[model samples]
Target: MTTPQDAIAARRKLTNRLIAGKDARRLAPFLASDVKVIAGDGSLILGAADVLAAFAGQFADPDFVAYVRTTTGVELDAEGARAAERGTWVGTWRTAGPQSGAYLAVWRKVTGQWLIESELFVTLG
Candidate 1:
């Protein structure tokens, strides 16, 4: 039996893999319709479409390398309908050194699956 935490962890891993592969289209399913994101650079991205656009734009850059997230923790609410995920993320580029930071993601259970509702990422180093 897969617990919700385990399921969320697996989803996070899959999301990381999709980002690393630059598969923006496939990543859509993981985001909520009204998802929001505050990028590590302090840019605000709203909506699933806009988020996908941001990712597509990033992937189009020739110097773009990869972004990978390592989840440190996942906490669920009492109802088990929502969860908060904390992790460290590292982004690499062909022309620049790697940048690493911490991130927080809020997820909701929708249609029996976990979808990212919002994410706030802060660049530390």
Candidate 2:
């Protein structure tokens, strides 16, 4: 039997894989329709389509490397339908130095599947 923690972790793992492959279409299922994101550089990206657009631009850039997130902890709510995921993220570029950060993602079980509702990423280094 898989717990909420396990499910969310698995989803996150798949997310990382999709990102590494630059497959935004495959990454769509993991995000909510209204998914909101505060990028590491403090830019706000609202909605799944807009987020995917941002990713598409990055993926098209020749110098853009990859962004990987490593989940350090996950705290599920009492009902197990919602969770707070804390992780560290690193973005690499071909011409620029890497940027590392901490991120918090809010995941909600929607229609029996966990989806990312929102994310706040802060660059720490």
Candidate 3:
């Protein structure tokens, strides 16, 4: 059996893989149906479809990429079923200027799969 710490590490790895591969569709498996996402611009969005659509373009952009500055987070649940991962991330685009910010992602375990329930990001100037 995997430990709570191990589960946290796995979540981090999943995040990196999603970014590196630029696979937005793959994110579905890791997010709950009613996931809530708060954008850096202060937009509050609900539902996985809406959140996924908002990011679909960016994810499909070959020139757009995101890098994680650090892998630091805490397990929110004692069983390691829920967790929060926060760290600085930098995103580069072909048109707009590079943006860096801090992100807080809250994940929950559903039927043995870790899914993101909520995520909030704040731009750092």
Best by the lDDT measure: 1
lDDT of 1 by residue, 1-125 (tens): 99888898899999888988997999999999999999998999999999999999999998888888888999999999999999999999999999999999999999899999999999999
Model 2 ranges off by over 4 Å: none
lDDT of 3 by residue, 8-95 (tens): 5677677667767776787678779999988877899899998778767777776776645354656566666788877776767777
CA shift of 69, model 2, Å? 0.4
- TM-scores, all models, native as reference: 0.97, 0.96, 0.80
Ranking by TM-score: 1, 2, 3
- Candidate 1 residue pairs in backbone clash: none
Worst 10 residues of 3 by lDDT: 66-75
In the order shown, what is each candidate's alpha-carbon RMSD? 0.7, 0.8, 2.3
In angstroms, the error of model 3 at 32 is 0.6
TM-score of 3: 0.80
Clashes of each: 0, 0, 0
Best by TM-score: 1
